[model samples]
Target: SQITIPILSGDEVNAILILETNQEPRFSLSDWDFARRLAENAGIAISNAQLYAELTRADESKSEFMAFAAHELKNPLTPIKGYAEMMLKGATGELTDQQKQIMHVLRTNAERMQTIINDLRDIARMDARQFRIELSPIDIYNVVIETLRPFMQQLEEKGQTIVNNVPEGLPLIIGDATRLIQVMTNLVSNAYKYSPPGSTITITARPETSYRTPNGNLHKNVMYISVADNGIGMSEEDLQKIFRERYFRSSNRAAQDQPGTGLGMMITQHIIELHNGEIWVESKLGEGSNFQFVIPLAVEEGGDTPETSPDAATEPASD
Candidate 1:
């Protein structure tokens, strides 16, 4: 005699267990019950394993498509940007006032597109563990000033005021100047996006005795910097999703209408981690938001701090 148990997962029989033995009585009631229970669990495990395998394959395909699409889009943006710049500069011919204004808008958006493409590539490289940063002594205040300079006209248009509270005597920290500038630019731009006209944005910095790294390790002697704005703050839900999802825009109607790729904070977080530092945020729905990050201070030497090595330097920005 034979006893068989059909393993059902969801609405489908995924497998079965069969007991075959030449015995007086083939199986007892208790034996049948135990076999059925074991078969059901086995069916669930098999179904889950198959589902996980499918998901992994899908994720890999998505990554490949993203990398390829970004590369193809980036190649043409450079030439498009160049032509737009030349037209704005009268390289093709002298343009009327109206033509110049149109060309300026075109050029500006082209640059923005290039930035988006670069961000996409950065994200893909980061996933592949190809992203890197060259650590060096950086003057945070100067980087902030320079990064904010380009937005002066926009600030004026919005009637926004910026307060730079970075002290003059702040110590240089070990970090990549360009990436740090990128971080500041993103935070400031985000502030500008959600804040109303005439709002105030502040940048502040201070020295820290010790800081915690992402890996739960503690290190001494770091610098803390923050960008704060009296903008439309995010809810706890939005705050949680910001760093986790790429191209995630806030559910706030105001923020949704604003222009952004949403990869900035994620890239900023990665850069901070590469420097063995931490990044965080604080906000309330009705009040405002503060984005903060910390980087290690340059090692003290007798005369001058040694320059950081260029090995594993940040990958070149996609064209």
Candidate 2:
């Protein structure tokens, strides 16, 4: 009254049927064959999922690798482009005021290009985990003052405000000051670029002791700096890719024909990592943004804390 059968084909096989002796059994090869087929289908589905997951991981890794490589190669290229552009316009030779004016434009664009290339290179180097820190003890308050002085005209003409939140008596830190300045420049420039005509950009600096390695050692007290703007913030999707090498442009870039190699954050991130720091962002799509990064506080010396309105219409820094 009972019958049992096993179905076998290729490496994949299905269920074995069992029938009790107490009941009449009406099973044969046909029923067993169908059951085996169903089981094989399930195995195939599982295999597909595994393959898909592998593919996703590979894609992310490849993206990260290329991005890092590209960033590392772009930094030193800036000055090269700048001098070449200058010579082409005969900056060394005397020229009329009109000619000099056009040459100035050429220089400006060249500088912008250099910024983009360098930013890309730095970010890539960081992503690839090959960046080395070149640190020194220096006052950031002086650094900010010097950096903003040149941009004063631009800010004033646009009716923009620059707020400093760094207090006096803050201890100097051992950091690559030039690179640190670059980070602030990128953040500040992005804030200014995205803010409306009459808005403000605030730069803040404060001592932070919260960043600690799992080991008990205090990971050099850190400094938290943020460049914030009340501008046309960004979407979650846009925010997700801000540090990605992939170009994600807001509407302003498209309309103004804003140009960049889209490597600023890639470089900024690398610089931060090289200094043993952290970086992150917070924003609302239409309201504002705060781009924050931290650096080792005592990597050289103190405690300190210090220091936007935008409704719309500017480039929100290229990714």
Candidate 1: tens digits of C-alpha lDDT, residues 107-129: 88987887788788888788777
Instruction: State the lDDT of candidate 2 residue by residue for 192-240, as single tens digits.
Output: 7777889888888877667543334354467777888998787787777
Output the number of the TM-score-best candidate: 1
lDDT (CA) for every model shown?
Answer: 0.82, 0.66
TM-score of each: 0.79, 0.60
Flag regions of model 1 displaced more than 4 Å. Answer: 1-27, 126-130, 167-169, 211-219, 284-287, 301-319
Candidate 1, residue 244: the lDDT equals: 86
RMSD per model, one decimal? 5.8, 10.2
Candidate 1: global Cα-lDDT? 0.82
